[model samples]
Target: MIEKYEDLNESYVTAGAGKDSTSIFYWGGYGTDQTGITNYDKVDGSDIRGYLKPESGSYNGTPNLSANITAWTNGALSDWNGKANSNVLKGVTTGDGPYTSYATIGHVLNTFLASADAKGYDDWYIPSCAQLALIFMNLTSVNNALSAIGGQQLSPSKAYWVSSEFDSNNGHRVYFKDGSVNGSSKGSRYSVRFIRDI
Candidate 1:
């Protein structure tokens, strides 16, 4: 019995896994236009981000971390979230992705996305670096929906956080401006785009 949530601006398909199975959707937040905005939507506290994971294997068949890092920074990386997550895929489900509960916005993002009643689904999880890259590729469609709903647009050249953690202190941040995935401190402020399983 998955909970169903809808609102004047509920963006379900965008948040859920894509029909391509290789892509993921970007759920829009309450923005200036109010597209897909839901009352259940909540952003994390200011300056409250944290690490996503300590270590990850590789993206798809490319075990070379350097190559994978180079891919996203150039353009959006498109790999099936399920098919390509050979290295970063973890079993952490709703209420279980974070090392702790409600300690930071990063944890909250994982927990909420897992249990969130978006389009009557509740199997969301934090996306690995590769998965995030797919979302980056689909940002145009995503941003359009957000703009229609008066939501914020993801800046083209800004660093957006991915769930890939390089170490205890750092997680991956994808540069939407370029497509480069770089490791940064978890506490550093950046935009979050949480992708769930289809």
Candidate 2:
């Protein structure tokens, strides 16, 4: 059984364990950026209210990829706005499938968490790549809370999908084993842990 604790914060709830949950999902199809939305950076009181420009460039092994990842992971919380990124994907209808058709990860997440009986909240979303890194940085604390609540512990061997997209074909993900962020084909299957504002 999963139990909710107010003190546990967003990190705990986003660690892939909660009321009713699964371990893996696709990152979903591509979409345009969703601007002018209010989103949060950290579980703290910090708020970022604007649209973030979509990240550009090639996938892993690029000359500047490391720097880009570093900036994303260590930069402002606003750049890691998974909610807005997920919202963008949610509106997509040109490729893969539409969000309303339940053909993508965003749709699946909405169906799972938007219900009135779903963990007493309905705003859960796929974390951005940087957001996933933040969760990894606090893995110890997150795992502790999961243990307390009888939730599934995030595994180090697993790769988790994030809402950040690299292009129409690839999306970002984080490897828990080394906390490395990289881009992969959206069609690739990986673990997904939802996050929301507290």
Candidate 3:
């Protein structure tokens, strides 16, 4: 069921999903740049639970992050954005896709996030591995909230991509398997899921 930002709230709580693992909120936050590389770096009050929308195309993760990639994360919490920006700075250029050939995840995901609109907000960005983990941590609740609108992945059968890079030739992903994270080739085709700041 398609929803508005006004709809997210505490009622979707699942176990182990809070700052203390015992509560829920309309939004939640984790991770920041200043905190270095910690998984759950909270930046004061970036309590934004991104507005996620599952898209229906597969993209390749190539062209590498060596091109002039652009990072869209600033004044936001996740370093994924900064890293993505840095990666884009390294990208050669941005263009259209069957991105399945040689375009990095940053090129595809960041471009999508930058233009996405959920409810009324537009400050969207990709989730870091840690931020993606948060979604996995609360999958049940996340699914519940999304279920109302015939949303995707109420029972996901595959992994979703993450914006974090493992190196110049690889990227990361997570899904419904015990939050098990792994790396894939940048040129490999994978599923796409976009999330926005709330």
Top lDDT model: 2
**Cα-based TM-score, every candidate:** 0.43, 0.61, 0.47
lDDT per residue (tens digit) for residues 101-132 in model 1: 11232333333444433444445444555566
Q: Model 1: how far is 28 from its true place, Å? A: 23
lDDT string, candidate 3, 86-136, tens digits: 244224222123222333333443333343233334444446655665565
Ranking by TM-score: 2, 3, 1
RMSD in order of candidates: 15.0, 10.3, 16.4
Q: Which segments of model 2 are wrong by more than 4 Å?
A: 1-23, 30-78, 92-103
**lDDT (Cα) of model 3:** 0.38
lDDT of 2 by residue, 1-198 (tens): 222322133432342343223334555553433343232232112322111221232232212223334444332332577787777756542235332222345655555565433477766677876667667666677777887876667776788777766555666676666555555666566766667777
**Candidate 3, 99: how far from true, in Å?**
8.1
Which stretches of model 3 miss by more than 4 angstroms? 1-104, 110-120
Highest-scoring model, TM-score? 2
Position 68, candidate 3: lDDT: 14
- Alpha carbon lDDT of residue 64, candidate 1? 24
